[model samples]
Target chain A: MIDFKQEQDGAVLYVDDEQNNINSFRSTFRKEFKVYSAINAVEALKNLKSYPDIKVIISDQRMPDVTGVEFFEKIRHIYPNKVRVILTGYSDIKAVIDAINKGQVYRYIDKPWNNDLVRLAIQDAMDLFDTRKNLSDKNESLQSAYNELDKFVYSVSHDLRSPLMSILGIANLAEVDVQDPKSLEYFQTIKGMVDKLDGYIHQIIDHYKGSQGKQFGDRIDFNKVVDEIIESIKYHPSAQGVKFQVNLEQSDSFLSNKMNVKTILSNLISNAFKYQREEETNKFVEVTGTITSEKAEIIVKDNGVGIKEDKKEEVFNMFYRAKQDETGTGLGLFIVSEAIEKLAGSIDLRSTFGKGTEIKLILPGTSE
Target chain B: MSDKLSIVIVDDNEIDLMIGERLLSRVDQSIALTKFNHSTEMLNWLQREDENSFTTNTIFLVDIYMPIFNGYYVAEQITQVFDAFDKKAIIYLVSATIEISDNRKLMLNSRVEGYIGKPVTVSLFKELIKKHG
Candidate 1:
């Protein structure tokens, strides 16, 4: 019912074995953009070679001798950046899935394609292809940067740790003779500073390691991971006098990365512990998980210094801290936000300023 | 000479070298585990030891995070020597923090025997011995 004219700047190729399909596509899309049609995969390949500017290819699945998936898989090696879409029937769902999993098809439209939706999907595919190409170039640069940084870390740690350890070792040896209060106090302060620097180095290593994998995902456990986190934070100085509550409604297993989920939880929990009221107020943290047909949800609620409603969105931004005295890298929440997005998830924040805050993460689950 | 496994580990960290020796000793107490806190000494020793003079079962466990000669460099050298001297030797890399995927790819790409994560517990060393034996 909806009308869509091809707004693709470059020429679009419609490859189908049916002659009627070629006519239908041309009539529907020729108003706003140039359309190219091929009755078979051979002609499509020829057209691809002839027209270098063809940015998108919409191919039908049920072609003679070769299916859309096979055709695109062959084309992918040659025109690696070309946007590919499959027009398949409802009966060919399994083949469509195979095409997607093999990375041949970008999107699949049912045989009775919605005219507007098909056009829009094709346009979106082109835009996505361009974005992926740019991202690939960026990834290459990041790879070099990662290697250089790793080498730098190894060198710096090797050069610095030895001298620092020797200095500290000699200082401890000398401490046996010194009995002055001020001298000992000064040595203690220097030792503290050195330890702090070492801790920062470890943090840098962890951050570098965490940022290395940009690939989307794998299977992740929610329950056992949550248990480990609770155990890790139970003895923290800030968590004193705070009761922890946990509730889970999912099958302890899910298909996602455990590290990304852990990152999100750790950030939220750290913030919760950091901003707790110092008075005789009842302090507690409640973590709950629920899985529905659509998505998995995690709610982290803490009785802490909640942000103002207006500042909730800004908190997720990098290096944006509400308190000037808060000693944090500020990259923690930013990394959390990035991880959530990479998983195709959304985060919602609710807070009552000066009372409490709650963060909810809704992530796509395995059911789809 | 066949009764004891004479192994040499090259790493800059005294703790890591000590730990490696301790772990390897658990596998075979008769094992003559020598530790080198410098890579140049390691490469020099390997060069001087002739194939017939040294035991064929000798292994070189090298750390990848050293200052001068890294595990990759040591691996390349050993492979070259194996070809030139017509001696068969195994090189295993150890590192604390390298990703498993990256380490696997590097080992496969460079034609090395294996890699073990650092803080190498005693059990892992035993497994290595069992597999290599």
Candidate 2:
């Protein structure tokens, strides 16, 4: 209930064909609450439009034109939240009761209704409106908060990471000047540590983005997205010898958020590149997409150093790296999983220790 | 255009400014470099018409994040100043800013040729200068 309620202002609307009934209702309830009265169905709708703040609407059943139930049903969609109370005679009770769910009527009033009973019904309806309005207002604030967090994440990505890049740049210049073996090794170590820290920061950002709720929709072309991702990731340090093979059969349309799809693909593809075994000469990552109207199924198969049997389940855990000594941030698979979850998708991983790893994903789309 | 190009580097961080100077000097010893630790000061220096005219075929590397005004705003002021002075220069928004909006915004500015991320390698610098220089 709203803490500040002004009883003097009009909060209840009464509609009846007879002027005497309208006058009677006004005289009885005018002191305790404000009341608005309309003589016909046309005037009743006008009253609702004129006084949008009126919480409760009461209409007499024996109107000359439309019945009370018919009037309420016609205007229900326009003022679905407005407390609809039907005042009907004994014969009209069945019609009024039936319209309760259809018209979202709050209650029914008998023709010889008591003043106290009518007053209580109107008060209850007003309370319902207050509760609903408060909930919707809270939802609006949550949406605003979500937007604010998006901006904060953008700031944190730039503000917190730029200084680290500067340090890395300076360190690159220092390596050229410092020729001593010990100092050269120190510089290499510094770069390694800095690079690791940078990886952590990126994963943290991705985690936040992935864990967020579903995003806006844009129709996705799997072939185009896969090609774009491979081109972008080809510049990574570990992408030297790895060959990318892509096959997509997507005649039917699939709709999804572009960023979420990119995140999932990029993490899986990059990990394929990063975890490749040097001994394996023909290193390759194969990506296949089969999209139907309802969902898209993607498979990323890599002939790289695959995850061990015991550690397969643990790969999706944050900061849990399968290969500890390989300068890898354990958050890549975790990020991918989060992105998949956000899209309401599922993933299945199959791998052999020395041979390769294959990850399959089924992402749902809007069903036609 | 001259064989030895000029560079006007502006950054709030003193260390980044020095690193840029060192890296560029290593690329071409004879290249003229004018460094500024403040963006607004760089604007003031650009507007000083009484001094020797700042030459054309120069590259302006402006840091994106700064006090008072951002790099995009500074780029706007520089573009205006250049147009007024009838001076021609290319602006490359140099920063570690991970803002995705930069790509769209970069395309909007005619003066801004490209965006170069931090610790820009010798190969990347050489590639950029080779294409534009």
Find the candidate with the highest DockQ and give its number: 2
Q: Evaluate candidate 2 and give its CAPRI docking class based on DockQ.
A: medium
- Candidate 2 per-residue lDDT, tens place, A1-368, comes to 11123374438888999888987888888777777888889988888888777888898988889888888889988887777888988887777778875645778888887998988888887787787778889999999998998878877788888889888888888776688989889888899898888877777787776676365476788888888877877877788888888888998877777778878988887887888888999999888878986889989898888889999999999889877687778778888888888788999999999899999999998643
Per-residue lDDT of A1-368 in model 1, one digit per residue for the tens?
Answer: 11233565677789999898888888877886667889999999989998887788999999887999889989898998899999998899998898899888899998788998887887798788779878999999999987898788765554555445444543443354468988888787776566555544544555555565554344566666778877876786677888788887876456665567677777777678777877736898888988653568989998888899898888888878788755565666787888787668999999998889998989885531
TM-score of every candidate's chain A = 0.53, 0.73
Candidate 1: TM of chain A? 0.53
Which regions of candidate 2 are displaced past 4 Å?
A: A1-117, A211-216, A365-368, B1-4, B50-52
What is candidate 2's CA lDDT for residue B108? Answer: 79
lDDT of 2 at B5: 61
Q: After superposition, how far is residue A156 of candidate 1 from its true place, in Å?
A: 9.2
Q: lDDT (0-100) at residue A216 of candidate 2? A: 41
DockQ of 2: 0.63
Compute the interface RMSD for candidate 2: 1.3
Candidate 1 chain A weakest ten by summed lDDT: A168-177
